[model samples]
Target: MRALLRHALTEQGFAVEQADDGVSALEWLEGNDVDVVITDINMPRLDGFGLIERLRAGGRHRDRPILVLTTESSDEKKARARSAGATGWIVKPFDAEKLSAAVRRVAH
Candidate 1:
């Protein structure tokens, strides 16, 4: 999934970064400046919700846009993500065009 997303986003002319888990993702962010972030809900170590919450609590990436891309599609999960400060949500098996558009919209 990560590889697919990376390929799709890269084809859209965006430089993509990937991490296998939320812990590693957070670690990468510590030394990088990114325009936006797209994450899944069920990552190992921390999970997307926890990552968003942690980023929100931190000073650096608080306003950074985070989009959740996962197979999990439920009203409850969406609301939870919103409350945790996710900028947007996209279900898995995503459309490349829509994904690119969402990234473009939030990256600003």
Candidate 2:
């Protein structure tokens, strides 16, 4: 999924960075800046909701866009993520064009 997103986003002229999981994502963000964040709900070390909460708690990432992309579609989970500060949600399997468009919309 990371490779696919990287290819698609890079093809659309967006610089793409990836992490193995929430832990890695947080580590990467500690030293870099990005316009958008797309995370899956089932990641290891820290799930999407946890990741979103941590990001929201940080001043540097609080106002950034975060889009949840995952197969989990339960309303309970959706509400949980929203409360955790996710800007949007996308269910898999995703379309490259639509995902790219979403990234474009929130990148600014």
Candidate 3:
């Protein structure tokens, strides 16, 4: 999934970085700043919800746009993510154009 997203975004002229899990993503964010973030709901070390919460709690990335790309499609989860400060959501098996458009919209 990461590979696909990176490829698609790269093709659209956006530089992309990927992490294996939420822990790695947070570690990368500690030293790097990005215009947007795309994460999955389920991962090891820390789930996406926890990641979003941690990012929201921090001063630096509180307003950073995080786009959730997951298979889960529960309204409850969506509400939780919204409460945690996610900028947008996209279900898996996504369209490349839609993903790119969402990224562009949120990044702006």
Most accurate candidate by TM-score: 1
Q: Residue by residue across 23-94, what tens digits does model 1's lDDT show?
A: 999999989989998989998899999999999998679899999999999999999999999999999899
Where model 2 places Cα greater than 4 Å from the true spot, the runs are none
How does candidate 3 score on lDDT? 0.92
TM-score of each model, in listed order: 0.97, 0.96, 0.96
Per-residue lDDT tens digits for candidate 3, residues 1-108, read: 778888999999999989999999999998899999899999999999999999999867888999999999999999999888898989889899999999999898
Model 1 scores a C-alpha lDDT of 0.93
Q: How many residue pairs clash in each candidate?
A: 0, 0, 0
lDDT of each: 0.93, 0.93, 0.92
Residues 14-101 of candidate 2 have per-residue lDDT tens digits of 9888999999999999888899999999999999999999999976888999999999999999999999999999999989999999
